[model samples]
Target: MSQVQTSRFNHKKYQSFQQSMPALKMENRQWPSNSITQAPQWCAVDLRDGNQALIEPMSVAQKQKMWNLMVKMGFKHIEVGFPSASQPDFDFVRWLIEENQIPEDVTIQVLTQARDELIERTYQSLAGAERAIVHVYNSTSPVQREKVFGLDKQGIIDIAVRGAKKVQDEAKKYPMTTWTFEYSPESFSSTETDFAIEVCNAVINVWQPSADNKTIINLPATVECAGPNVFADQVETFCKGVNQRENIIISIHTHNDRGCAVAAAEMAILAGADRIEGTLMGNGERTGNMDLITMAMNLYSQGIDPEIDLSIADEVVATVEECTQIKTHPRHPWFGELVYTAFSGSHQDAIKKCLSVQRDDQQWDVAYLPIDPRDLGRDYQSVIRVNSQSGKGGVAYIMETGFGINLPRWMQIELSRAVQEYSVRHSCEVDNETIYKIFQQQFVQANQNFEQQYQVLGYEVHKQGEQESIQASICDGSVHGETQTIHGQGKGVISALSDGLHKTLGIDFQVQHFDQIALSKGTNSQAMAFVQIKINNRKYMGVSEHQDIMTATINSVLAAINAYIDAVQ
Candidate 1:
């Protein structure tokens, strides 16, 4: 036969499908009473649906890596791949059986169309696994029947019955591998509710699923309709109408075409779904599948153990994005960059005060943040940053984290104005480091009074032979314009400078530990140093930055003494 003739025959075969039968409509399309408090067991379809949608599908090695990560994340049942589709998929399934060390408790699932050859191949793929499930599905909606496939209602039913028999017969060969029969009334959301139940009941009978060999009726809101509650009502009605509730596990697969997939799945569980099939971050064909991570995390936040490990969710999202070439939006819930970050002034201030009061992050409300970023292996450095939107709280956070300089209430307000002005002018968000630099340039350096209180003109260090000592010459900027060039010797350059200041200005203070950190990337990155000084049991802080550590050290020490004097009087 010609290729055109072959294409025509295939088209006719699909078009022969019939319309779904309608049943008595309920008085009110409402969800079941029990749906208020329930969460379903999750089965991630990333390796199958997600991989199929990727521009460049993952290699076998990459697929193995993803599977291992998913298993680590406590996924007991993972739809690994569609085995009968291609050579690589077949090889990947065989690889899991031959080489991969799948856990004794975990079950690997494979998908295939409702055909005998594919069903046999699917069974071949499950060689030595302790637990394996065969997912058999065929389109049953009227649109699919009339437009896509020319099948009458009975034609679709015959296809389903034959498919279920083939799957059951093939699965019988593997008596050792516990078999699970799952059927999806493909496009169930759009099909007549009564017809969907009828088809599902037929499969349940053909499979002869006992309570032990439980069959799964995966009722997907394949194309989401109306609100989530409406879909919930449909699931509730269908579950109530199905013949064998004890012998079947009601599973939900919702697509996010209407952005209600997650809500629908949650409602479905309430309406009586025991299992869930979705993709991570909702990656799939159309608008994408429901996001399992979001739903699972939602349950976690509500104090319900969804029985999934989300500790590696950050890594999972990153790996999937690389393979799929789709970036997770920065505003995406739970994992977004700004999800835990707060740019608003009020939120920043509250978080700063909370951090000050309780060193433990768990105790803080962390307004606008649901969970601690550290819990997800993310840093809290970006939580509070500066912009026109920032406030005194943001400035204080910068002082505390970037420079060890703790500003008083009055000082914080004074600096917030300058930082906010700069942020607005630049039209950009600022980091703690930027706020620290601004604070230094204005409060520490711009004021001549502060500079005059104590200023070091120049200093040189010379090591003496007898002892490891250093000598430095320094000048002071006092009100009397007093420039006293004094020479002092001490163990270190900072010590020598402190000694020179004490002698010249009649000021005495003990130099505490000094710290320096690189401010940027490059060979010539500036080293920012903070000097802690204590005089008469009162602590003082000073910060400075320079290309040379020695220069920064000298400036930092003097700044500390100046701050102490200003604080005291």
Candidate 2:
């Protein structure tokens, strides 16, 4: 075959071809009233559309992996590939059925132009499949006649009728397997609507659609000529005009040329489309196909079950990127890295307040957010970040959630001032480590030796074989300008500290809970301890830091005692 045979029509001519259509806008698109009526079956063109768009199309193994993922995700109908175009595609379909890899419930579809040799090969590829759909299409637009293929409308119809008869004849050989016939009027969006309906209606009569298993008429707004609503109008008009409604399944295949493929699809469904055909993350030729993941999850957020398992959408996209060498943007809807992240102060403040409210009711009541990120397997940490655009509530929430520190209103205001400045210097994405480090530097400090005031330099305890008491020796700065060692026995470290202080200075405090956490990763990470103590029924909190948890606990107890003494003095 010459290069001209494989070549597509010029882009300029397609744009010029669209000028004959009506000019329309989709400024205020509305959601469908009855979301439940929306069809659940998705005919994923990932292997054909997505694979072809790759810089290097997938190997047979990679295509099989993608096919497996599609079947696993509950797609009964999948367009595997255009088998007539490449030997790998033919081999893949043959291998799938020959190995019994094609699931029983799934019906694999293959694409072919309206040519006898190609149609025969398309049939040859599906010989082993228990169920298959023969998808045949021909270019029906006027531009193909005058500019590209030099074929008139009648000539195109003749080719289509011949293809339809060939498919019908082949179905007789496979008596057990159910044969589905699908026809697409290539470049139908830019084609004359009446002509498209005419050609499709003729194919419908030839294929003989029925009430039980209707022939699917896939009307692709192939290049996305206008806004989504207009496409919806176009689809509604076609469904209304097409003969034998009960005998036809109207499907929509939209490209994202104007970035309205998703919108177009949703609106088309509202206008009565029975099936959706697209690729994951809109990966295909040009701007790619409509993202079924985004579309399904979009309905999911609206409290509608799109009936497709999208929980592994991220994994599928990652595998596609690896296999195809195409990258998914971090800001892509649903699967993007920063889609759930909020750095603006006001946004974070609202999220924090909303979270506090939601905790009480276990329901969402927030501004600018519809569904919880956790519903999509995302965490709450990235929902808010401190930045120049941040508000005071965000800082307070971070302090309260990330660390156990709850600042007073006055302190919160002061901290917000510092946070705003820091946010201006570094972009708004302040990580958890930076916030913890900053809190430590500003309020807590490391000290080598305590200046009297009940210092706990070191401590050791010995329990003699399940005895009721523990003996402890605590080393602290002595009153006589020396390091003094004191011994006491109690139930635990807090009790031991209280007993030793009572023996030395006649001051005592009740021991409370000692809370500790490993502050960082790795074996050398420090332990942070918070000790709560009671003196005359008045509670005081003291925070301590040390590499060893035991030492940190001792320091926390001593710090609490010193705080009590300072309060009294």
Candidate 3:
């Protein structure tokens, strides 16, 4: 018996998110009425935000590979690095500019803290770019303001004001390059809604952004502390209170600390945010950023063009794994290798039926799959993988699709049980080839699966009117038992074979079922036969494939007789 153990830590020490974060002051929120109909302005932050979260950060080569991959995926704005903090980041930025690597259309962004020298260093890194966004941020949550910075509300606002002025002064030095300024009230979700608006407005006043020359006001859920609805309320309240709402691009940067980063980002978008900042595969600090891959796929599933190419999703995920030195979980959403694969019996059965009626000209309406996996370069062959948990429909689908052998209902039931036993015995999923092999060895009696007590050698059938006669040669298990022929007469070849088996073996069993199908569609097509017998009210089944229908029928009955004999012994 297991003992009841109490938890060691005290749960009373924790506070609810509402108690910790400041309340919103909106009289009537309008975000609930909104819905996401289109993709937002996307900014890839794999290098800046994602890199900082890595325990062993990407090497220069890895960073370059990741950068090139991001460009190819159609990201208009990519936060390349935190040039002000890391020397490697500074050098990489310089390399992009010096080597003419920045594309004419793409805008590379860099991040920095709201400090004097770091802000200046950030500008230095983007020296010769045609256009760039200099992102600056400072923590503004209640805990961060009081405990970390030991600053009052006004003092925190002053820090942001000074940073904004310095950023404006530095941008004047480079008149040739187009500049877009971005400021973040980091930890915005847990900060007072009115206070966050005030800081953003203060920064906007210094920059004086206009409709023609826009700037970004990023609000980061640096540590997600509430539900998506609460975050949406905070965003809506900020959008209403902030200055120059038209000029300021309300961007959301979310962390998955509470696993609601994407949910919050989606809600914030409905709350009037215009941009999203995230990393590929959601690789960032803690639980990582909202997975851009999942978000993009979500949009794609909804018939919205994500503006990013995911056709080579399998290849892209492999590259991300290689560069990050992290293996994607097989069950990870969308991009995982096995997310499109089904192992459960019900899931596989539904997927098979849906796929059979699916057409390229029509909308995707598969039962288990939301989107056609072929859209992402995945073949349908991997859709329904068979395992111990799989059922007849899955086995039948695999048999027909993989080997072109259509299994009848009764045969599918028997084959599925054989597959389950084999899978359990091997302690793994039974692959397509293995499923076929199992059928051949266990049912067809072709692979010497076990010491068969009755092995069919050959058979000849004679038909007159509706009556039939069969003479089958089989090796009955005994000391020096030679191949012997047994003769029986019945209404057809199948009944004659059953009659011969029961008379020879002295086991009275009724022929419960019989079936057959062509292995191919030509004159040289092989015949596959199946048989089911009931002895002592217990059913046994068998199968065989051969060029001659008579031979296949004979072997199939003999296989069933062998199964019954083995079970009785």
Candidate 4:
């Protein structure tokens, strides 16, 4: 009673598990040597699996919206729903058939269990469908067979064969419509490859498919129980053993329980799968299905057309979010809000250099970015965000892209330090507007605190022969804040202004760098001037914006003078 020691803490209480799923026992497996050259026929299961997994299934209107979006994305085969399992699903299928919302080129696929009654009801829901696929499934894994259905190997085979027969019989009744049959030995990932081939072959024999009406043998990694390589082996084994290879479409439906659905789908394709069934953004049960968006973009990044139009990825994300009520994770591949953004200093610097170069072709060669964001309807402004970790290149990118101000190399370093200080003080990301404001406060408005000093009230410049004369009026606060007018002659307005300031207030500086550009376009467009001046071996920068170029230049020089005075004082 004082101290109880229990044997439950011993590791021997748990049984040892298999290190890996059994590898297919063939030395001549071709899948490992093959590469995916073309895209497989795509089938989106969002309406069925994706919808059923939702906490609140999509209403009829929402289903219609999703259906329209899929059609627009050019899906030839779409699994509308498991009509026999849900009333709304049945009604949605009937509505599509009756209202003729189903396009002639598109074929609607509906799912059903192995039971005869559910197969009959599934066909009823698709009675008037012009072209449809009847997908029937029965679990075949040893655990599902014994624990879920309490059936042996022969018993499971009977269920698949009977379901295939019933679907073929019902499809024959509709003489005017084109019908395709798909059979899934569900949970094929955990099933013995030999037994899975037997059940699928039995279903194919009952369906009696020809090349014109090929049967789809969908092998679902329904629970994703193994690594991608093991799943690929399972597919290779089934493809090798299945009879009538040309008359069957070997399809793969993968889940993401182990976060390997995309990898599994790609491996299955390499293993000779002819079709892929998945949903957008991987929305489904458990960890969700393989993300068709990721898979398609992966193909695109490799110079292969995924055969789906993803130019409007933002719209696709918006529609899916609205229908599913699930916000896309910010780090989701290709489609997330922040996938393309670079917060690291080195990454931003590399990206800035890449974007600055002009390419002769449409090749995307940017660093740290797999695809051009512009290709996906996103602009380059949001690619680099400023934080405490930001560097000169990232800050310069923001200024050039966001505010149209191309800061010089030296100014970039200067502004980056200010921005980093601001970010550290606030402990958050600095927005574009805040960055612009900081720039203005540092350069353009540097003289606000020294307003009582010498201020340029007005300035006029005139050129004569090779000489330019500038007459400037200033309020000199150092001289009891009195107003004084001074004149000087030089080669340009900037030169003349420097001479005038030196004569009026004994302030002398040499112009190091001067640049100007129109801030915008139009008759009323303003001009921006950037001036760097060296006073007593110390450098200072100033910026000014005004309607007149001469006035902006003068203001910039005066602001630089005040900044230099403030520093020395």
TM match of model 3 to true structure: 0.88
Q: Mind giving the per-residue lDDT tens digits that candidate 4 earns over 99-170?
A: 989887889999999898998899889887778999999999888888999999999998888888888888
Better of 3 and 4 by lDDT: 4
Measured with C-alpha atoms, the lDDT of residue 379 in candidate 4 is 85
CA lDDT scores, all candidates in order: 0.78, 0.76, 0.87, 0.88
Q: How displaced is residue 162 in candidate 3, in Å?
A: 2.2
Q: Report the lDDT tens digits of candidate 3 across residue range 461-541.
A: 899889898887888664355677888889988777767766876778788998888898788889988888888999888
Ranking 2 against 4 by TM-score, winner: 4
lDDT of 2: 0.76
Best TM-score among the predictions, by candidate number: 4
lDDT, model 4, position 383: 89
The RMSD (Cα, Å) of candidate 2 is: 9.7
> Once model 4 is optimally superposed onto the true structure by TM-score, how far is the C-alpha of residue 53 displaced, in angstroms?
1.1
Model 2 regions lying over 4 Å from their true place: 1-19, 23-40, 359-363, 406-410, 415-428, 446-569
State TM-scores per candidate: 0.75, 0.75, 0.88, 0.89
Better of 1 and 2 by TM-score: 1
Best by lDDT: 4
- Model 3 error, position 536 (Å): 5.3
Cα lDDT of candidate 4 equals 0.88
What would the per-residue lDDT of candidate 1 be over residues 1-569, giving only the tens digit for each residue?
65653344454443211222333356765455553454577788989988888878888777887888788888888998999887788888888888866888788888899998998888888878888888999999888988988989999999999999999888778888888889999988888878899999888889887877789899977777556766776788898999889888999999998899988998888877789999878888788898988888788666677787777657977876766678998877677667777777898888888777665734535556666677667776878777898789878887767766666565577679989998888898876677877876865564335745565565567777532333444545655546557566677667677776777667899976677667666889777666678899987767676787777777778788778777776
Worst 10 residues of 3 by lDDT: 445-454
